[model samples]
Target: MGSRICVFLRRAGWTMWLAVLMLGPAQFANAASPDPSLVAKINAATFEVVIPRADNDPLSYEKPLPLDLLPYQERTDKYFSVGTAFAIGHNHYVTAGHVLLAAVGDLTGAPALRDANGHVYAIDKVEKFSLQQDFVMFSLKEQPQGNAALATDTKAALNSVVYAVGNALGTGVVIRDGLYTSDTPEDENGRWKWMRFSAAASPGNSGGPLLDQNGKVIGVVLMKSPNENLNYALPIGVVLGAPDNMAVMDKRITYQLDVMEDTQTSTFKAQFPLPVSYADFSAAYMKLLYAQGDEQLKKLLQQQGNDLFPHGAGSNHILHDTPELSLFPELIVRNRSGQWSYTGRELNRVPLSGNGYVASGYVGHNFLIHLRRPDDMKVATFYNDPKQMMDLILKTGYWTREVGPEKIKITSLGNPASSTTYTDNWLRHWKVFVWSLPYINGQMEVFALPVPDGLAIMMRMNSSMGTHDSLADMKALTDFFNVDYGGTLAQWKEFLADSSLLPEVLRDAHIGFDYGKHFSYDAGNISFDYPSTLQPIAPDNMLFMGVGYYQDHGKFALQPGVIQVRLNSTDPDRISAKRHIAPSPDLDDNFKEAWGKLLHKQHPYDGVPYNDGDEMDVASVIDPPASDAPAELYTAFYGTQGTHKPEAMKAKLKLLTQQFKLKTH
Candidate 1:
């Protein structure tokens, strides 16, 4: 299972793992009914917390269903019931902190209270909040008159009968009875004990009141243990003892980066005066939380120091190795041996309409997605239509959400709420899309790389990931991602022409061609051209552009360092070329020495054309006019049926580099 991430990129969420369910209604466990008079008093004090549904929200599913399948109020309701809250005093109301958080970043609406007779009350101020204890204290703008507050019992005896009361599943006040079980320690240092009872609490029971047999409030219902029917709640005593008019957060977080196995645990603590409106509280909390994320990320990187990616012993081999030729979207993770390598092929693949397919699997906190176009789909349409692409992906690999036993397949995501292409430090361009998921109170972030086959995507969502700076985190991880770019001649044409979809650098490194005639590839500092005579062009002929990071450059350089044009998709007969940059000190000893030999022209194969038997011809030049010391050699080779001599290979090299119009960066 992935981190339940319906998080952010530029926004927030360092999503975590917990059994606690979200805003969905909780189950109510019935052990015994509470006193009838007490029930009436409690009902008047307690109100259902609801976040109004957006009027503009529309869900497009795979097919239409019978009108009766969904309740009329559910489909046409103005508000969505999340949890419950009740009066603690004349105007003071209390609910689980997580309940208010649903409003923190929500655009649909802030939380409000709904009475038994269908009246609504707006939340006025957040008097207090605590993340760890999962509680929030606030007041209503227009408090209901004559609703008596529920009395609190700070020292209720363990093993006594208690009533779990709330607007069970939004059907109005319902009280269920269960024995007050033994206390359970809080997760972080056991700072406090939670009241655990064998109450059959369901989803909607969260934030409700857990009362004693006398109907005195003892604790606030939070979550049910996923393993058993027992439930957990914050002892009412803790809430009463907490200082007034303050917001405090003390939660333990395990920092997890996607590229490595290392983790660091730290407690996030912050405090500030409250009694602020929902808007002010949300803004303040987001600022502090995002800042905390940045600090923690920086601290973790600092703690690892040179042992992190592109620095430690693990990255040495990958830094020196040529671009990984495989185009599947996969993470570059540091293996147990302390060597960085691409995640393997144990991914889940699902077929799409056209022969196209999507593959996905976990990589640390994130997941990698590769969407390949079906052979029958037009390259241009598939490459440009991101909405269609994502729709296909969601329908297949991810699965549809269930609406009443009917699995509703998402038909489309419409347009991205925001779209921008970010070029990472290594110069890899990622098309970023943030789809507003207002219905869920978050956004679906996507960072997609345009590859030859299709899009290589990253980002977050798995509602459980629970908020963090998802955008910034994914962008940060982009540098460690390793992939190649390859496509057929037809794919190249469509991909290159769509300037709206092109990355900054790719626009300059134009892949100019004419179906079966002249073809050329240009990089910022190098250019190569070869006529169709070398390898006749067909729509299916593959062009594999190897991209690698040259860290020796002041800023890392990720470009098409090597090029191979093969005959059709399967034929080995091909033409290849590379303009190499000499390695820095980190490379293996043998590699450095071998390149040194080539630079000095000591070996026959060094800058010398040769036929290495397999009917393959090769030649290399240590440094052409535009290249310098660190920029070592340029080579071009071809493999054909007929035996070729040194002269033939040199001719091809000259043609490839004939147009040396490279502007060295």
Candidate 2:
């Protein structure tokens, strides 16, 4: 059976508590009265949450209001009992996020909780929360008279007897007992652990404290699984041991609430804590667009169409067409057949008829995922640690520009979360970072996920600075992201190999490249493997075969690197078959011809030897098995000594000899 969360709130000064009981301590068989001292502290420390009474209430924890509204504003008394929460840290109380969500509809108001003594304290602000873990931490506007000590250890022995304390069905503060059975995985990422118990808990028991024999809070009751008697709680250590500090002024969010009548499922709207500003969008967009060592990204953009970027510069409309658009709250994709298809996945329960929404923005394009990196790259550098990765982005100027060192605001960092997904072959950890980019005038995010035995898969999402509701859209994109983790190493290598980046180097490493079919140079009676990266340069006025064959030229130019070659043929001995030629007669008077296939020691100046300059190899008939047919000349030019390696040139010359065929006249 599906799991049900237990958390409730009331809208008045009087409050009550209930928690979905997870593993609880065993009740004494003799059923004697509990220790008076412990009970007194429990009664003093625990409080009942007050919320509005609504039939089939949708559990939500945000009190969304206009920006002008102050925190904890006044509201009417449509109040009732939610689950229980107990004070822990200095003036702070902890409870399940879902419980507080019950009274958190579209209104802004301070929710009060009443202790056993009927004294009430207002919840001041949400300090921290974990959506994956289902917990929320907030402080009291005024400190309570008493509070409970929290447990520090995360481990609980199997079958340990624990007490499940909560406001049972709003009757009063009640403590039940159950055995801590075992731990279970609660999320797809397998990074979080939940406590399981046999406690007999019902609706009003959620968000209450699960205490050990010492009465120290160990876990917070969450919900129960419908399959059996097992209930679940989040470990108290996890709630306290979260990775980030509670430093932001406000940590609450507005959510569109949905609750199923059967109580089988529910969905709460989620949004980014801060909207993406335009500067943030520009910075992130430029970084991905100009990412170092990302040759495939360029090709992928090219495949879509060159018109997307006119004259090598991105158009303003590009902001809407880029991959970052996937992070939008509303993403509509156009299929290959020219028909638009809705690819968005909702985080809510299965949609019932007309209640769902389709995202808006740039509406007619496909989101192609670039999920792998080069094999030679270190995967650890991507996201082994979240902060380090952020530092890298900052260093790359992906977030903010570096002008003055004193302008750095380290304390500005906030909104950190870890997401993960696991399959039999892979365990993926996505360290998520959300921040405002003043330089780009927008809010941006980075998802650094490492691949096993490969490079890191980094994805970026950006949005306008004022638009904060895009979590649902991001979830849909992440669902699409999971598909690539299952991609094979061969695919990644092939993707790199297919690009114009060091393809030959990858091939030498046994990562093969397919250059398609060889272009026939029928005019020169020669054909050989040509790199796919070479582009045909026009010969508007260039001379080849007395200018007659210029239109049928067999020459091409390499991009990103300057190098050129032309395929032409002459009589068998046009240049020289000799291995070496002494310094030219114009430069050195007395020199002898050395015999070999390549002619060596030639200079461009013809009469001068400048900066180790020399004329390279001249193709000729094979010396060992001299051929009788016509031999084509393979002449090449190199601007620098190191621009092209001599051994590589030799290989190309040798390949031409092997594959070159002489067509009979």
Please give the CA lDDT of all the candidate structures: 0.71, 0.40
lDDT tens string, model 2, 473-584? 3333332242111122333343333332221212222212232323222323223333322212221111111100011133211101111222211111111111111222
The number of clashing residue pairs in each candidate reads 32, 53
Worst 10 residues of 1 by lDDT: 1-10
Root-mean-square deviation per candidate: 5.8, 23.4
Error of 2 at 238 (Å): 0.5
Instruction: Output the TM-score of candidate 2.
Output: 0.34
Q: For residue 194, what is the lDDT in candidate 1?
A: 81
Candidate 2 residue spans exceeding 4 A from truth: 6-34, 52-78, 147-153, 244-665
The superposed Cα distance between candidate 1 and the true structure at residue 415, in angstroms, equals 2.3
lDDT of 1 by residue, 1-665 (tens): 01111112221222322222223222223436676676667777888788777667444667764436767767766787766788878888888887777566765877798876668899899998998888999888897867679999999998999887765544545677788888878765888888888765765567888989898889988877767767888898899889898999889777767777787677788988988998888888888777778787878878987776667667766666566677776677787778887774437888887557788766766767878877787766676676777777776725444455565566676777777788876665778887765555556788888876788888676331234578777877887776677888777777776666565457677677766897787776677677876567678778888776565456455666778888877677777776555666767788788677667755544545555565565555535565356455655656665566767666766666565444564
